[model samples]
Target: MFSLYALAQQAPSIDLIISNCKVINMADGSITQGQSVAIKNGKIIDVHSDKYIKNKYQAAQYIQAEGRYVMPGLWDMHMHFGGGDSTLHENKNFLALYLAHGVTSIRDMAADISKSVVKWRDEINNDQLTGPRIFTSGPKLEGYKPIWKGVLQVGTPEEVESALDSLQKLNVDFVKITENTLKPDIYLYALKAVKARGLRSSAHIPSSLTLNEVIDAGLNSVEHLGYAYNAGIPKAATASKASQFNAEYAKQQYRYMANHHVFITPTLLGSYIISHLDEDSHTNDAYLKYIGRGIKNTYSWRVDRAKNISAEASKQRHENYDNVSKILPLLQSEGVKIMAGTDAGYLNSFVYPGIGIHQELALMVKAGLSPLQALQASVVNSPAFLGLTEYGSVAKDKRADLILLDQNPIENIEATQKIHSVIVKGVVFDRRQLDKFLKDVADQNVSGL
Candidate 1:
């Protein structure tokens, strides 16, 4: 048997070690103090008491966390990358914005730039690019002559199958079907077909169908909260030909959703922006400094439409937003898993990509979720949405996608904004480096469309 010193020296070396920290246990909203987390080859190898790690292990690099809070990096579940080639470089710059703000992963809903987005996703995964881990839906499935560009238009079951076949070839993480004139019956067919092919499916529920109707047809996640709000109104079943939205009925529907394991991305921040556009013009939003001219141009369509609405229409928009936003707490109370998404990206006015997720968390708390619950919506719920078991928490053997905050986020969700450091794939970026990422993006000067 070797001496203690010799045994300690024989231990295998790791790449990085972070000691003197408070690790947030996302699983139960608890905090483990005085901890040290170890990483090797881009995965967490050990997370133990600080003294234990400091005395027993060695690494190529060591970061003194200095009692800061560590938690899993955030996920932005809904965002788009589009605007054709003119904005390609500008759009690609959004990646740096995400990392600077502690967003380690994102779910890119399909846009016109499917092929390029796919390549970006691959490159990011292979460590060839600097960006969040991207899981894209490729080109969304829609009907012929759909308003949105870069979609697989399918009018029949055969067409739907062919589109899915193409998506399969692309090895897309999941499938996204929209309501842009896609026949309802065929939409249901596509959902079933996607399930049969062993794929997860999310959709923009059409007004003609009740929330319950779509859930029964194998829809895994609802993209936005507007449709669910519509389903909860009294006489919804009779007037809109969908289910009712009353509390008792809502309880039943939520129970059904929990049993079925369907997820919801309220994307309340986007709705808030839409409802209050008339009140807050966002002309001076400092975040605009980072948005490209081409992407800023995309905002005009929505803004112009919002500007043209009458006072009464604007009030109704506000009322609609209030009603929809209120449903967020109800979903949480009923055991329905919520994924925090910003609905951020091109064409969604004022919803910036990087910082939008923080806004989403704040809104969730305002809508009645605790800070822990709100954090869960992004860090915990998002991984489950993708059926990925390796991420969403700070634990041994987990991917080293995490953020170190100067303040405790559990005390206030806004503390997340005080990012002290970020670790993506075991690569550490301290405060100075994070600011450099932001500065690099702003230097693009992509504004002034």
Candidate 2:
């Protein structure tokens, strides 16, 4: 007969254990203290009281949380990886930045670097690369002679079908259609086609299409707040008059969106940065050290464009951002889901990757969401929208993508920035390792690698 000590010594061994932590339940923002999480094979095998867990299992690696707060790793649902081949290496460097900032997953909303992005996505899943879980739309669909350099230009119904076929072949996470140069009719048709194929779709609604029309046509998400705001006003309204928030029309739009189960990725950080560029150029920003020369070079165009704007134009930009941001609370009240995303990548000016998602969360709180609501946008709503059932919680069977914070993010959204450690696929990255990720990227940037 095996003695008690012998049985304890033979307890099942797991990959890692995070003990004595407060686990934040993203489902409803509840906290369970004195908990221990056991992870094995990249999945949370069990979560129990620290005493119970310690007696029940042995782990190869252990993290003594020391009363820290633990939550699911964040997701940046709307970012990009573009700026052409020359910036590919610089863009690839963003992966480490995301992991360093406790972002374990990201959605690339279509960019010029689809091929590399797709390859990286698969490689990361297979443990061949180190980075956030990538969900990419691959190359987006556009019209003939589209302004974007990398796209599958389709003007006909048959072409749209073919474009979608290609996307399926690449096994993209979803379909992203933009309004830049795509015709309104084709855009509507593409949305319907994507829906018929049971593929999720997100888009920049065309000016010619009403918000109601796009929702009815099967657009799963509205990419930015400006698009939804524009839907509430008259098409004839000028840019200067776009700031007028129409309560009744917006209410109807919100209801329509909620009823259809559509999501909104406000990407507020990018707009906020651009709107306030006249005040802070971000040239002396400390985050610049981690960005490659090629990526930093891409920020010039947006900065120069903002510089030439008249004082009145700058004022209008600020007012527009403020007005549109106010609708976020209303959207939540009306039952619409918000996904926190920082349109952070090449050509978006100063919105830095990795850390940008934290800034986005703070902005969401400033725009009237509670800290929990903001947290849900990144960790909960984002994965649900992507149909990633295995993520978004620190529970049994959930993916072991988590972050240990120095403070409670539910109490203060900014607490996310105080990450003590990050775990991606059961591999723990302690403070030292996370800092090394940042330092390595910075060194690569300085060396022009």
Candidate 3:
């Protein structure tokens, strides 16, 4: 029942109010303290010293931010929510879970179920859901055959044309193309078609395509760092002709991406677990409580498989993860627009959806990204890359997608876990409220009684 119109009437009409925040404005490299932020409806109406705002405007409800660092609620760009129907039901709870953890928006990278997600997107805009804003590819585009269910399979040039046309009719948020599942030629054709329809195209870069081919085809964005690595290989130009997924051949793809202006997500944590999962027991993970039971059973098979791999091969994967860690800083220095996305899902085992992102940020920090820079990867940088002008920053006229933390995240990125409050779509939830929501979910999910 709470929409922007309903919330605005109760908005701050008062002059100066206090939020007592340690602020991180990733926009201008500004970090300040004891400041107050003002709100009008769901947009940040003003942000000034408490006294100044108090004397200037009349307010209705004053949020006592008290010793908190107020920053933008996060946007996780690389999320997916379906392999089958059970996930569609779970998607409703998924939104609340993200919001509970301060994620205000999510870009789904193609779920098998499209109808519910699209409906969820519209309903969230209409204030019908209490979760993050959903932006989705709806379904993935593959070639020759639909290796996964709910895909828009394009086998030839005409099929590519038809799929592109269907995207428009379905009115999806973006386009997601996978590599191994499709032929590069027709996939490129589909990318061109996406552009012609005025939609942004992003994909798991086919190792076969050179970085130049991707940029030349006008790819809107590339999804992961591994893909960028392939593009770095000079012979990737020839790989497209032969259609091979040889990472070693495309080793220096980062340089090509930097030169040609392509973006990479580098969902390191998800990759970290997937590639090196055999290293740790899922039951022993620090954040295991955050994983729901339904999802935890799915993780056992992978962990069991990890136990059989040679210790030497396992050691090599750890080494690869360590090497991959360096890409975060390298991309930053090369002027690559890196956005934080967690390929966190049921299939990805151990990388729980909500908490895995915090782990991802910590890994990025270990790899030399400043805490400020890492926050930008999740917040300001993500919306900027997605061209979402209204939601990322905590500024006047920006949507009220803000999170208040007990500690300054710039000082320690893990301070993100000390969440105190979150304001999503103008509805505010303090720590107690969030705790209750999570508890109720846990009880209902576990007991169903």
Candidate 4:
């Protein structure tokens, strides 16, 4: 038998230990109770029974989870940061808001402030700043006179080549292409080029081209559900018709997506909010206080446009949301990877950052997903889609980005919002500190700094 001195010498010293927690295994939705996690150098060094870990290892800091649920920190796969130069400071404040809401990572799907976003991403990675881990597409690719601002306009194949070169130089996480003003042919060409370079590409499918064509051309992901909905209908069929929900067509489309490994970020929460804006103006929402005036002003454009919509059109919007949301379950059933993204940020009225991921999970459950499945979308599927091997679970050898909740989220998705503490890169922020983060953002917003 080994001596106690030898065993003690073998035990590793760790930076932090979270004991007596129930670890939620995102991979299979199982819960391991009375577990302890040992973290060192921002990675989980060990995870085992609380008694075993407490007896073996020593930690510099300890958090008695007291039987709370511990799971991976949330990832918002599709969000933005842009309201032009005037709202740059406001956008910066969103970082704290994300941490306050237990979001450990975010994917910025292109915006006007590409340079600033890149700097912030680097700073956060280097631990020079406090914010969620950022993976930005830099500036998205568009066409001549695109509807949106701050895009790389590429009309010809040569211009597309130039755009890709620029994006590669900037070292963007992925390539984002929008179809607002881009020609259908160029869109396909850009997708092919991005594929040839071995870079993942996400985009809006042009109405002129079928989803199959885009996927076959090497499109990695579809940003919104509308495109997937459109794919389920015949090209000649009117998309506005209630008859658009063809089960056979949808099954075939979803099956193709699964086979090809094309991920989909439904972003259902934003659609739900906009669809029901007439019923709840959200003027008195407590979350609004944290949003800067400049960013809030950007909300008016969409709000004004919604006010002009006729009652019949408003009803149609509600119907459209319901119809599209129903397919979320179908997508999951068919083995399609559905990533949870809130589409939260500037220009998207009232879809607040940070807390938006929790709202998105709840909406996913409402749309027929199990709470565990919805949690997987944020913590599991997101990292898988991004090929991040270090994240997405509460286990040894994984990144120590986690959330401690008073209740199990698998029991009720809303429990995710009941965060007791957040740990990013092995750094813990208790409830009090998280609340302070929110308060500071609110104070900054009020001061317009």
List the candidates' TM-scores in order: 0.96, 0.97, 0.89, 0.97
Model 2 clash number: 0
Which regions of candidate 2 are displaced past 4 Å?
Answer: 234-244
| 3 against 4, candidate with superior lDDT | 4
Q: What lDDT does each candidate get?
A: 0.89, 0.92, 0.74, 0.92
Query: What's the best-to-worst order under TM-score?
Result: 4, 2, 1, 3
What TM-score does model 3 achieve against the real structure? 0.89
Number of the candidate with higher lDDT, 1 or 2: 2
- lDDT of candidate 3? 0.74
- Give the alpha carbon lDDT tens digit for every residue of 124-232 in model 4: 9999999999999999999899878889999999999999999998889999999999999999999999999989988888988988899999999999988888888
RMSD of each: 2.2, 1.6, 5.6, 1.6
Model 1, 97-168: lDDT tens per residue?
A: 999999999999989888888999999999999889999999999988998988999999999999999999
Worst 10 residues of 4 by lDDT: 236-245
